[model samples]
Target: MSGKFLPTARFLLIVSLLSSALAVTPSAGAQAEPALQTHDVPVAGGPSGEAAQRLADRLGRSHTAGIYLDRTEHRFVITATDERTAEAVENAGAIPRRVTYDTAYLDSIKKRLDTNFKTPGTMWGIDVLANRVVVRADSTVGKKDFAALKKFLAPYGSAARVIRVGGKTERTSSAINGGDYIENGVVSCSYGFTVRKKTDPTYKAILTAGHCTITSGTDWRKSDGTYIGYTTGHNFSNGNDFGLIRAYNSSVTYYGNVEAEGGTAQDISYSRDSRLYETVCASGYKSKYACNSVGLKNQTINYTDGSQVTGMDVAFICRDHGDSGGPLFAGDAALGLLSGSNNSACYSYYQPVNEALAWYGMEVF
Candidate 1:
């Protein structure tokens, strides 16, 4: 988004999910709690701090998010709506920490965005709100620099005092402009590390959804920007978008639709998406909260502006694009693949990550 400072549903959803089953409710043995203002706590947006950083990236500044600060640890937190955003924030030199938010707050944010900001810049359904900071072009303002834009936003919100976020401009036509830059936009794939398929020290070839492919001719690699393999096969625009390319020499690994908490792993991978009813969780790159999940799996899903999305896919409390190809596990069984979500750009959907693997002859952990 160009410039806008507004909270969103992404905040509430993440807060609800994290504060719910995840955060260890202040234990009985915990220290006495202090009296607090339920509404005044300065809550940062999203679970991952990427939202803030992305805004900064676009604005050409540094803004960190995910501050779980209080009396205990005074350190700032960064929440990336997805793994890539998380990585980007970290790479950009911000201190990142995973986080979530309250549902009521999220609900209120949605209502607020409608009421506030007469004009929005862009909408990604994440940390940053998409509203225009400059209503008049009296003085030329370039979209490339946010510092000037932040000056415009200071009156509404503390652009300086608050966390900043980064954003990427939409890529223009690469097909027609035949300049000499070597080529095509990259189709990338990133998968949640599977547990079953990996050991402590050995490198494992992880499987991922194929829609994320950069095409068959390109090679695949780790997020660190190293080559690992290539797209041997892929499918997209349907219940497809799966791909398989084994590690050149590493052992293939698997991860059940579950997660590791402290010392325990929960099996979240659903065998049949048709039966999904209860609140399911999803994660994506809002550039704010890293892996933010929302409750309530909405039915009658839509896409690309209310186009009906067919078949059964998983929906979480919240998530977004850039989080695509991420794993969507129910407990520890590897449920689905993070595809697209209907709830604006803030939420996301996933194909069965395991199924994508299976089609390519890759095994799930």
Candidate 2:
């Protein structure tokens, strides 16, 4: 059931059905079955996004503030801190613009805040387009805490920006569950992509949100309480939120497909870092599947539960309870996992899938 077998399996199934139909003497009274024709699935994330990622990889994160697609022109626009880096970007066939701060500097600012001002109900992320670190405090932040955060960030001047939004942040795991949801006895959460160890192909695991596996050693099950897997590795603190689950039955087949719109399934090819403003799709137990654009990257989110997850990205998509650990992808590329969302659930924050894959030495199957 892995990716290697998907196309072949489909082909064989089609052939078998056709053979069966041919063998059947179509009685004049029997309505003919509708013709079966496979239509090509559309791929997401065009060349513009891939080109920016390649340049960003070559230039490194230190000198590059951000790289995104110019929607109007459909070209890659890269922001570089120094003239030398800008020249390098130009030479690489991208449009380079000068910016005051590099991603490294913005990351440093985030670190400073992470160390000193980890106020709950607040989150911050680098805005590469604005060339500044944008700090956001949701409605849960009291006036006093907001003032304290503002005062602390005052020294950074324009390098740091702060704003307020209208919702509280919360993980989407649910206690009340029905349907085919995955559960860890305590809370129910959505399942993510299936992955295999890079070094050991026989070892398989399921990727999910760290908060879902925060209680390490917990056994996961299906809604009916059947055994599914167990938490092997989970990271819910220090601005990270991803977890791994070793499959209970290693010999069982697991496909690389995710439920897409209209009850269809899309095969996941690989994982990659997300580009700002690029549209991606998410699938979960609650929300099913939906597509939306990326809002920000390298974000630090401080949940109202006194927990924090850094290196998150914000999306314009909406999610519901039990959507935690869902998959966010574009085309066949796995991007991130559902982390949490604001109180109103208007937008979502996710942990990049590549980060979890790297940390656990795994790849999507």
Candidate 3:
């Protein structure tokens, strides 16, 4: 972690759960779906997002139960609950599909709906081409709490479904001072990458958004106040959000680049895994650089403060409220952090910079 002047350094874009600004009125002679607006017939080679996450981590998690891409036959469907893992996912190029539910049975029905659903405007993930466990719910979720959440999943029928969707999942903080973002002056978030210490390479750090170092504590400043790092470790909740600041200012200096759009800076170089429809891009201190794709992956997010995270990864891109721990890229790899957003259908949500650099073993700088 060395640098090239951070001066006003900014990063953050967390804001997801559901932010669809209430507009579900289409029943009167509806008719929408002009093929959801075309575009998706571009298949050619397909696997790259680190070679489809190294063929879904070399087909592990009991024979891969998830992997997306398929943008109108672009390729990489994966799923495979058996048939010998769909012949090792079509011999590792990806196209599988088989599915009945694996990936440890949809991660044990998302850990029994994250241990008896906390339900705050609700949320849930794992679609793996619809293998199950969707959930969603919003509009403040109250039809008797969506019918006791469909009678507590009616014992996992069809593995789980539910559905409703339309805004109402919030958690946005702001204070971040340092000319523009990276704040611990109180509660500001976003600044995700510039790490070290795969066994102590003089240990440096920054990766953000485990609810912003558990609600902005663990000292971390920058806008002239200096100080730069501390939250040594963090994980927002059961599904995980991510954190780990540690840098401790060795006279502050850190760079690998990232912060692009106009003021320029991009070069990250490594970190992948997140490839359902590919194309990502994020950077925030209030929705800075934007670009989208990768609609869902692993995902689980269930917050309204009932707090519950889980391998998140969705993207439509929009982010706001100081974009919590920003940076979710594509050009120079490095793939996630922006941990949440919806700002009326902006739909971001992240956390997977190689599983927070392998749960803080760290890397990237």
Worst 10 contiguous positions by lDDT, candidate 2: 34-43
* Per-residue C-alpha lDDT of model 3 across residues 142-247, encoded as one tens digit per residue: 8998888788877878767787766666655566433456776578876878878878877778888888788646788765667787777888766777888887
Ranked candidates (lDDT, high to low): 2, 3, 1
The residue-by-residue lDDT of candidate 1 on 1-365, one tens digit each, is 22233233443443454334222222211222321211212223222222332343453212222222221222223443445555665565444433233223333343343243222122212232222111211112235433443453465442212122122111111222221111113643345434223233233344454545534345654444445555555565443545445455344333343333222445443333312222234322231123222222221122322222223343323443444455554333455655454232233445555455555544454
Instruction: Name model 1 segments beyond 4 Å from true.
Output: 1-185, 193-205, 214-217, 249-275, 283-302, 305-309, 342-346, 353-358
Clashes of 3: 20
Q: Each model's C-alpha lDDT? A: 0.35, 0.74, 0.67
Using TM-score as the measure, which candidate wins?
A: 2
Model 2 TM-score, 2 decimals: 0.81
Model 2 lDDT per residue over 177-229, tens place? 66667888788898899999999987888999998998643888866677878
